[model samples]
Target chain A: MAFQILLNIAIAFIWMLLKNNFTGVEFAIGYIVGLLLLFVLRRFLNFDFYFRRVIAVFKLIVLFIYKLILANIDVIKIVLSPKLNIKPGIIAVPTKLKTEWEVTLLSCLISLTPGTLSMNFSEDGKTIYVHAIHVPDKNEAIKEIHNSFEKAILEVTK
Target chain B: MTEIVVSILILLGGAFSILGSIGIVRFPDVYGRLHAATKSATLGVICIIIGTFLYFLLVQELFIGKLLLTILFVFMTAPVVGFMVSKSAYNVGVKLWDQSIQDDLGKAIKKAEKKARQ
Candidate 1:
C-alpha cells in the first residue's frame, strides 16, 4: 500500500514536470492518469490496487466516527438521567482477527466506541475482556463488536 | 458565520468536558470511570481541536499542520491510556461496582487455573 502511494506521487510529479505546470491541479490530473495507468496494469501487480484498501480504510474511519458520535449521545443520556441505572459488566468478547495489529486496532476501537473499555486480551489473543457501561444482553454487545468494528477491520486488513 | 460555527463547536466541547467530569464523580468504579474519562474527554478534545483548526484556517488564513497532528495523536493514544489504566487497576485487584452484572474475566481466570492444575 505504501509503495503504491509513493508510486502514484512519483507519477504525479513526473506529469507536472512534463506539462511544465507545477500547481495542485496539474498534480491532481497526473494522479488520475497514474491511477488509470495502475488500474490497467493491475494484473501484473503483486497485490490489490491501492485504492481498494484506501476506500476500505476511509469507510472504517467513517464507521468509527459514526459509532463514536452515537455512543457519546448514549453516554449523555445515561449521565443526565436522575436515576442511576446501568448494567456495567466485563464480557469476554471473542474475536476472529489473527494479526497482531488487527487485534490491536479492534481492541482500540472497542475501547473508544460505545461505553466499552477493553481491559485485557486472553492468553490466546482470541478474546478481549471488555468493560461496558451498559450490557443488558451480553450477546448483543458481542454481536455489535463483531458486525461493526471487527467486520470493518477485516475489510481494511484482509 | 465562522465565529458562530467556532463558538458552537467550542461550546459543544466544553459541555462534553463537563459531562465527563460529572461522570467521573458519579460513576461507582474504576472501569466505569475509565469509560467516562476516556470517551468523553477524547471527544471533547477532538471537538475543541477541530474548532481551533477551523478558527485558524478561516480567521487567520493559515493552515496549521500541528493542530491536525494533535487531534490524530490524541485519538490514537487515548484508548491505549484507557486500556492501560483499566488493565493495571484490574491487575491490582480493584473491585468492580456492586451492581455490575457480570464477571466473565473471573470465569476465564478460573478456567485457566483449572487447566494449569491438569
Candidate 2:
C-alpha cells in the first residue's frame, strides 16, 4: 500500500515535471489528493490481484490503439466514395463480461470506434446491442467484438 | 514549405471537426447526427495530430512515438464508441425524425422469434 502511494506520487511528479510547471507546494497537494482518492476508491472496489488487472488494462489499451488506426482507414474509405455503399444495421452482441464497469468500458470502446455504435444492453446484461455502419457479416462482427473487446475485458475483470 | 503544409493540415482538421459538430446540431435524427460526427471528428483529430507531429519534428528534430500511439488509439476506438452510442440510443426508443425507411432489425427479430418457436 505504501509502495503504491509512492508510485502514484512519483508518476504525478514526473507528469508535473514534463509540463515544466512543478512547484513543490502544487506537487505535494496534488500527490496527497491523488493518494486519498486512490485509497478511498480501493476500499470501495474489490480489485483482487491488482497487478494482474493493471497489466491486463495496459494490454487492452495497446490493443485499442492498434484497432483505432485500422478503423480510421476504414472510415475514410466509406466517407470518400461518390455513392455511399454502407450496409448499416444493428447487432445483438452477447457479452460474457460480468462486472458493470467492464461492460461500461467495453461499451464506451465500442462507441468510440468509427463504424460501430453501442445501441443498448439487454435488461439482464446478457447482451449488448450495437449498430455498425458497414457490417458485411453479422456473425463476423459479433465475433470481432466478443474476441477483441470482451475478451480483453474478461481478462481484466475476471 | 513543410511548416505551411502542416499548418494547412491542422486547419483542414479543424474545419472537419467544426463541420461535424454542425452536422450533429443540424441533422434530424440521432443516427444521422452520429454518422456525421463520428466520421468527420476522426478525420479532423487525425489531421490535427499529424500536424502536431510534423511541427514537433521540425522544432526538435526527433519523433515522439507517443503521438503515433495516441493516433492509433483514437483511430481504433472512435468507431466502436460511435456504434455503441447509436445502438443504445435506438434501444431507448429514439426514433428517426424523418419517416422514409424500413427497419430491417425489426424484421430480423420477428424471423428469429418464429425460428425459435419451431
Expressed as tens digits, the lDDT of each residue in B1-118 for candidate 2 is 8889998999989977876676566555677568667667877999999999998998768889999999889866765666666667765878644342335555555776898999
Q: Candidate 2 — which residues are off by over 4 angstroms?
A: A1-52, B1-33, B42-118
Model number with the top DockQ: 1
lDDT of 1 by residue, A70-154 (tens): 8899888887888889999999999999988899999999988899999999988999999999999999989989999999999
Model 1 residue runs over 4 Å out of place are: A1-3, A23-25, A40-47
- The Cα error of candidate 1 at residue B34, in Å, is 0.8
- The model with the greatest TM-score is 1
lDDT of 1 by residue, B20-70 (tens): 989888888998888888889889989999999999999999999999999
- Total backbone collisions, model 2: 34
Encode model 2's per-residue lDDT on A31-94: one tens digit a residue.
Answer: 7666656656776655432455678989999998677556655655655555656666666788
> lDDT value for candidate 1?
0.92
Clashes of each: 0, 34
